[model samples]
Target: MAFEGLASKLQETIKKLKGKGKLSEKDIKEAMREVKLALLEADVNFKVVKNFVKDVSEKCLGNEVLESLTPGQQVIKIVNDELTKLMGESESKLELNSNGISVIMLVGLQGAGKTTMAGKLALKLRKDNKKPLLVACDVYRPAAIKQLQVVGKSIDIPVFTMGDQTSPVDIAKASIEHAKSIGCNVVIVDTAGRLHIDEELMDELKDIKEYVNPNEILLVVDSMTGQDAVNVAESFNSKLELSGVILTKLDGDTRGGAALSIRAMTEKPIKFVGMGEKMSDLETFYPERMASRILGMGDVLSLIEKAQEAIDEEKAQELGNRMLNQEFNFEDFLSMLEQMKNLGPLGKILEMMPGANAKELKDLDLSQGEKEMSKIESIIHSMTLEERRKPSIIIASPSRKKRIANGSGTSIQEVNKILKHYELMKKTMKNMKGMQKGMQKKMKKGLFGKLPF
Candidate 1:
């Protein structure tokens, strides 16, 4: 969703190149021109866009690409490579101090989701087996300390806070000793931010930096701010010598600017990205994987990782066996829906699919799909246990359908649609089971020589 417009345009431009069996210099020039426009329209910094286009165009014009068996694919690969390089070329992990507590100072302008990011990062570190302490250092904003406390409490992390009367520099310094006493291996200082970059803000941040000597000075930036985000990063880097950046609000209607421009502009790798408002939505930023997604090449690795984290392997296997054995029912279907919800939104899953057309996905009303899923869940929940296990009974009785419709607050026709869909799914599983049995019989007869009889 962040790069919807740019991805659509880039995919369309590449599609034309893919259709051409051979490419001429003129063809590549035209494609590059289109790409240049797309990036600019995406609000990518002008200098970054220029350098990206120049590099891609030169690579595409190379003889290796021009004479390749599949010139179109070669060109796409070159674009992908350039895109990755533009976004820091690799993942930049947090440089924690192995010997003692790692201090990370988070700095950003106001309204960049800094407080929430602190909780997310601490939670992530805790999952990695580190005891993390969150320090509330934002003494200026109203309720800033309270916000940090609430966030830390929700995540079950300790939040070290002095009152708003204390200077942030002093609060940050005190948090370290507090962390040491509690055996926290990592201390994340949530610093204050101003409406804009100012000397007072920088001086205060500098004071905290001087006091803490943090292992990381990560600048939290709102990715939706486009070039302004880049400018903020540049200013902060100039003052603080930042270790990395954490982009927030990337799930919003972002134009793909900050993510593409920050690293090229500031020479800092993006450490993490805030994908949603949920505490668990912070994801490690992988340049190669992001490039693949931008090129319509699907981030299968991230998708699989998400599945492994969210889906229970035992439950998934049981569900799979039930489906293959043609025993899937409304109960199983409900379980499947709950599992799917854990994988995140359907639109995001679609975005990770290989060759998914951004325009086509945009045309789909994903919110409506979410509502339909809720409706289906409601309809299923309204059914009796017997009806759930044996949907055939509901199918045969109109009165049963009427009862379910009334319980779910829907029309009978809607209830009927759900029943029909369930029947179709069961029929499909039955047919697949038959095909599998047939294949197994043939395999035993031919490959195993009648099982050594």
Candidate 2:
């Protein structure tokens, strides 16, 4: 939901264009005007917004677009391409040292979640078969060192620390030696942060940078700060020559001006983003995928990646076979629920789906859905194995239904509703399988299916 407001507005504006078989200059101008207002209202930097609208207008007004059979689609493609360009066109990777240990210095303001991002990055590297050493360089903040230690401990990564009395520069230099001694290939230094930018803090960071000569100087910023986040990145890049940025709390940023404007303003790529509170929630930033999401075109590639990470292929196949054979039961239902939960929030999952607009998504009460799922689970748990496998028997036996209702702390009416819905779902699945087979036949005859959107 990072760009909910902007995405909704852009999607609505483009929806109008898509409805037209032929477009005029007046129509393109009207759409661009709406887009400009949306970006400005989302808190984008004024100059960035102005340049973006100008570039998009120029491309959309070309004869190739205005004279094309699908003028609206052409305009969308142009906007998508320009949006990707605005955010650094491609993914920016972390700099790795080939000869020796790769050292990364995390720089940011105090409330930017730098310590947590260090743990997240270290966790990611550890998963990628690199031995990472986390160095405690923030000795000023109360409990900052202890917090990093806690993070390192949770992730099972080793933390190197000297006493608070030691200067950060010495600590960073010594950490590299420790990493070499232990054969750690990556060193992540969690540096101190000030409430606001200050000369003293900058001097300290610069001193540490001189001592360590880090491979990557990543600035972590809070995306919810909007234009202030962009301004902060500019300030940090000026002093540190920052290699990239890590935007934290992106899930909480609805306006998303900082994400859209930072790279344009600082010429720095966003290497990573903090999507959720979990250490595993840090994701590499992909500009093209983000642009697609912003325009409501959906990010199918990211959705597939998330599914690949969260689901077991063999189990999924097995479950599919069961459904096809009409053998799916309460156990399979519970297992599928667990797997879906692993894919993150339902709202986020819907955002990656084609044609799922912001208004409809906002109307989806995920918490209420979760509550309903919990109730179903409780009902299923109260059933006997035989009843789970063959729900018809329970439906036929009023006594059994009453027993389950008592066990699940619900009325018999709720039990009937659960059974009714389960039957409806099975019936729907059967119809879908039949439709899929029909589509397969058509596909074999050289017919391609159209997208639902």
Candidate 3:
């Protein structure tokens, strides 16, 4: 959803180009002109847009692209390449010391989500077998230290707080000794953020940097702030010599101007992006995959990674085996829904899919879908164990169906529909398995023999 507006506009422009069998110089120029306007309308920096359009236009005009049979496709590729290059071409890994503990200082303006990001990063590092210590250096903001401690507790990570009385510089220096005592391989200092950039704030941040000499100085910027986020990154980079940047609120940034322009403007790689408020929502910034998504191409790699993280492989394989044997029941259905919930919102998951137009799904009531899922879950939960294992009993007994409907607070028609759908799913899975095994006999037997439908 981050780049929905920009993606829709760019995809529309590319759609027209793809429709063409051949392209003329004038046609390419016209398309580039539209692309330029699209970028500008997305709130991308004027200078960045100007340079991007110029670079894309020059590449489109080259004979390598123009002389091709599919010139339009070639031109789109050039745009994708330029977009990837605009953001850093590859992932900017955090600078971690192999032999010693790594200290990372998070700096940003207030409301940029520095504290939350510290927890997110710690959660990620913990997954990599690193003992991460979250240091609370945000003494200015009310209850900032308490906020950090709360975040650390939720994730089961250690928090090193010196309270609000100690200076941040002193706190930062002391946190290292704390991390060493606790055997923490990584220390993430959640520094204070101001309402706006000021000399006092910069000096305090500089003081922490001088005291700790952190391996990575990450600037957290809110992507929804547009060019203001870029300016903030530039300012921070000038003073801190930032190792990288982290774009927060990216999921809500429909225009995505900051994501598109910050790295190019500040000459700092965007190390990560906060996709949502959940601690697991923080993701490493991948420019090529982002460009692919912007161009209406799905990010299959990220989709797969989400699946790997959310789904249990053993359970998945066992479920598949049971489905193939026509043993899938309401229990398995409930388990599948639980796994899907862990994958995040359905709308967000759909966005990562190829050809899933974010604009088209913009009007979809996700909460309504969630409510429906809850209703279905309640209906299933109301069923007896035997009824859940063998839905055929419910199909034969109207009284039982009515009892379940009453129990789930629904009508008998809805209960019957669930049974019918369950049978359909069972038959469908058998057919799919039979096809996978290249056995027509199994498919034929499963298709028309015992199924009530």
Show where candidate 1 strays beyond 4 Å.
Answer: 324-327, 385-397, 427-453
Who wins the lDDT comparison? 1
Candidate 1: clashing pairs of residues: none
Which runs of model 3 end up more than 4 angstroms from their true locations? 363-369, 384-386, 429-453
Q: What value of lDDT does candidate 3 attain over all alpha carbons? A: 0.89
Candidate 3 clashing pairs, residues 3+ apart or interchain: none
Provide TM-scores for the models: 0.92, 0.88, 0.92
Taking all chains together, the TM-score of candidate 1 against the true structure is: 0.92
In order, candidate lDDTs are 0.92, 0.91, 0.89
Candidate 1 accuracy as lDDT = 0.92
Where's the lowest-lDDT run of ten residues in candidate 2? Answer: 444-453
Separately for all candidates shown, the number of backbone clashes (residues 3 or more apart, or on different chains) is 0, 0, 0
Candidate 2 stretches greater than 4 Å from native: 321-328, 382-404, 419-453
- Report the candidate with higher lDDT, 1 versus 2: 1
